[model samples]
Target: MSTSVVENLGPTVQNVPVTEATAAPSALDTGLTLGAVVQTEGTTFTLWAPAAERVELALIADDGSQRNMDLAHTGEFWTGFVPGVGHGQRYGYRVHGPFDPAHGLRFNPSKLLLDPYARAVDGTLDYSSPLIYDSSDGDSAGHVPVGVVVAGSEPPPPISRPVHWGETVIYELHTKGFTKLHPDVPEHQRGTYAGLAHPSVIGYLVDLGITSAELLPIHHFLTEPSIAARGLPNYWGYNSLGYFAPHAPYSSSGSRGEQVAEFKAMVAAFHAAGIEVILDVVYNHTAEGGFDGPTLSFRGIDNRAYYRLGHGGTMYDVTGTGNSVNTAHPQVRRLMMDSLRYWVEEMGVDGFRFDLAVTLIRNERHEVDTVDHPFLAEVAADPVLGRVKLISEPWDIGPFGYQVGNFGTPWSEWNGKFRDSVRDVWRNSSDGVKDLAYRLSGSSDLYGDDGRYPYASINFVTAHDGFTLRDLVSYDHKHNEANHEDNRDGTDDNRSWNCGVEGETDDPAVIALRKRQMANLMSTLILSTGVPMLTAGDECGRTQHGNNNAYCQDSEISWFDWSLPDAWSDHLGLTRRLLALRAAHPVLRQWHYFSGEPVVEGGRKDLSWIAPHGGEMTEADWYDGNLRTLGMFLAGDALRATDAVGNALTDSSFLLALNATAETRQVVVPDASWAPAYEVVLDTSNSMVTEVEAGATVPLAPRCLVLLRAL
Candidate 1:
């Protein structure tokens, strides 16, 4: 906001002073609102292109006719007021300037740039058209995505989520793929935002006890030319084209500014169902990719200031997407912050999960600035972004990018170590139970030392990018031939194990084992002491046929198959049961990490790891690499927390035993100090819920998880 803040960003023009920056920062980003602002009588277009020699406004009508208008340059921004051009006016910009790629200034009036802050983006880019690139030197109006003017409206006040933070259950889902094949949803509304917000869909999530829906990238994106050439689409929507505009294709309503209203209604519907909407936002990179990529909004507007360019203006990509955004630039950061605020203030969304978030806070030197950075500093000082939830993927391909626990309190990170450790534990490949113990108990090794609590770790065994629950136990290697990249697109470090078979088989034994593995992993995910996130189709049986990299496959491979087959009914029921147990019990969800000591005088420890033979886990048990059996005892009375009504909280104690070895495990119940009696509430072996005798042995099948309640 101040001049010194700009100077502190970096030495390059990427962080130049507001008045001296190549791109217009003082007028457009410093105080003025960027993009199309609809007024009472007309609309005003504002853009940042301080290096441009000339700028013109192209207003396109419904019939495809356009009228040219000159924008008055104020030495800081190019703004023009077009009378009678209110909402629903499709438009693009033509900025005439130098086309010096060496210095990162690639402005070509031939390329019609979409507004960097476009509130509504309509239509798709004709990637095959040569005029869309700077090489053509011809008009690119019809071949590019046009921004539609949207009149701002007041969104309803956000509904308060009744669930506690500790009880949060995040369901990561695709906006369209979630309801694509729902048998109950109407045919017309299927696979659209309207379908996702249908009462049927909302009721399904409510019955399953989901607290939030983390939708993947509703931001408008473009299908990469390479993918398009292969007759494929970017189904994951990671290549962001418009940050403010909701992905138009996902809207059942029209895309001519109607997507905005439809998206708002969807949010309102989810909120009324007591489900918070958290967007899986991609702000680390733009669809305008590498140096040889197409001339999109940022590149044609101000390439040097909008992207992290290296020597000779080469794009510095850390997202593995060819180009990374220049958040170091004051205006670029403002664009990102503005998009975030707009989503919160206008869209009625609850939070965001920033994809490849570390790229957003990197300095001009392309190094991560963990402390005193402008991005985090602004987020902390802002009123809007402070209260809303902020999650980070927390890693990139850049140097020291694996900053899992580096982000301080008030932010949650996707726990990569938790996923790896849990996978290893279930696959019977873990060296010892030490890592699994830490992960199951909220990963205190990663988040404890920071000023954050147990909830800082967003624990998940399977996310959108990896194998689904069913596939995790059905495939040993990736079968990604459908991706068409010689099976080299997705990550090869998938810690999956085929249950005695490589692919789908008719053997009932292997099928049974696979389903049981899914149940076991789901149980572990829900019972863990952190915010649990479930991939969209994981609850039921959803398989990508070993295609872990289904980002380009929008067909049946990625959509949620809602038909509950006979094989997955048990697993789905178990998932619901696990979530219900989590919600009903207070000890299962703790605000703070377990102290492993008595919270009150003469009480059992809050948490204790027990050996199969009984009593505390000894050092020798931990030193054994083959020791895969683990028992965790949670004492209800030892928790130092209170209910929402401020009453001291107490709950029934629980004991969970997991065995991942070849031989079955028989865990002896602890002494009277832990629990007087125990009952089998859930078991992965046979879905049995029965009572166990006092101080009796609980039989756990190999690679099975059993949870019991202390009586």
Candidate 2:
């Protein structure tokens, strides 16, 4: 008789009815193992313990009762199943192993270890002596074997829905700071996952014309001991604890699975509104710091396999977080790749923005490989991940960290040069116009012949890490005293200038100049050729009270104030108009690099640089720092058109004039074969012109940018 037949019988009844006459199974079901049952049911668990001699599973109940289950091995995998124990059950594992730090193996079975496959972790980790091995004792060289089980439970199913890429405008935001002060969200839901998915929150994103919300890390993360002691939390969640589990602190509901469900619901609601969801992933390092740091998941599991260690088993501090991940190791590389795929396939994410991406491509010697790194090739070749948008921060704290345009083809990098150049041209002295011109034209000099398009440069003047657009024009220096760092922290060279006053004042002229500067920055960003990323609150003129580095402020200092004044409302209107203008014109968002020649036969040049007098630019004009006035004539018909073979293409003609001097300048309309008439489509001079006649000498206001169309 088969043991399966006997196990099928209930505990209350010894003999059950058997229809088949071929067999009569015994009551004792010793042959049917729990591991075999779990394997048959398509569920399995895996743990890495290179130092462990034995491992066991301990199941805990809500009423403090416990059940011990011995694990059965299948290769390196030790797995088992409790017939009635599944998804929502609370369980943990214990490993009996050595504590030889000199050999890089520190394991204490006395610690109740978290399952690496756990979808969610219940409560916060409590630091205790039982979690560590005493180095003073003789047994310290070899940790004693013991195990403790803790209570935990998973939540119910989530509402699943996935959105695609290409149509997504991701809004990167921190979970707590995003809705911590939102008046519409319930007090309990504030700063939680539930609040992020609330109808009002979703409505705000929809109103902003954004198609995707790229959230900062929500994974279980460790708060640095020093930061905790200073009464500050980790504002930027670069420190990760568990990859599969969601952070319990971000959950409004107490259930572990509820966090997962709420996160999925957030994606679903955004999808229903024709939006996508991308995640800003930090896989460069774990929360485990150097020698003095706590024993966490990766450190306790298989430190050698997970981390890049130095000579004599010392931790390598490449990520600036005490320890860097060994992506060169095949197993470590597999872990990262699997984590990314899991989020895309299971959680329905549209894309990923890799933090400190250069560190992930480091070779065996810990040197970053820009051209042919194994991890980079793996991600690019992946079928499930290939279609998704891959954005790289492209730099790290290591040597040769500035890799703005160094990433390979098919990867878009955060263009820091574009940000700094544009800011310097508008806010700094007049020595940056030449570099600004290079950035405005898709940064072709940086990404010219790499088989990459203009969009490969993700251009922006402001991001979450620096000043808001309002602060960029309102203050000259970073005021980080509110961060409790005595204002010594953050970047000293902000490249910002207060038109006249240092801070806010009742001076009408200063206020007007600041507003105009805001307009100038927005116009430059939108009109430039690249993928433009607007910081969420910048459009509405949100400020951080001059806090450039508000990493710890969870108060109103970080949240976006919804009730903006009428003046700010007007600015928002202008921002929308600029975006619409960018979307309306193909010349502004060209895919290919400017050819410099006439795009159309018998037509004007694809692009022509001119002086303020409307004459062709001289070599001397390009070198002069004081010559800030210029005109760019774009030939619309000169744009190349493609056929079925994907050849080069062309399009109509357009003209733009810019003047940064203290007085207005007369711009001449150049003679072209396309037409004799030119019409003004947009004029920042008056901010009210719909259209103007061509071939007319227009008086461009000081520090103004104007757009014209050929009729």
Residue 254 CA displacement from its true place in model 2, Å: 3.7
User: Weakest 10 consecutive residues, lDDT, candidate 2?
Assistant: 1-10
lDDT of 1 by residue, 528-640 (tens): 99999999889889899999889999999999888854456777788888999999887998979999998878888899998998788999998989889999999988888
- Residues 349-462, candidate 2: write the lDDT tens digits: 677888898999888888989888889888988987886678899899887777888887778888899998878777646672677777888888778768887878878888
The TM-score values for the models, in the order shown, are: 0.95, 0.84
Q: Which candidate is the best by TM-score?
A: 1
Best candidate according to lDDT:
1
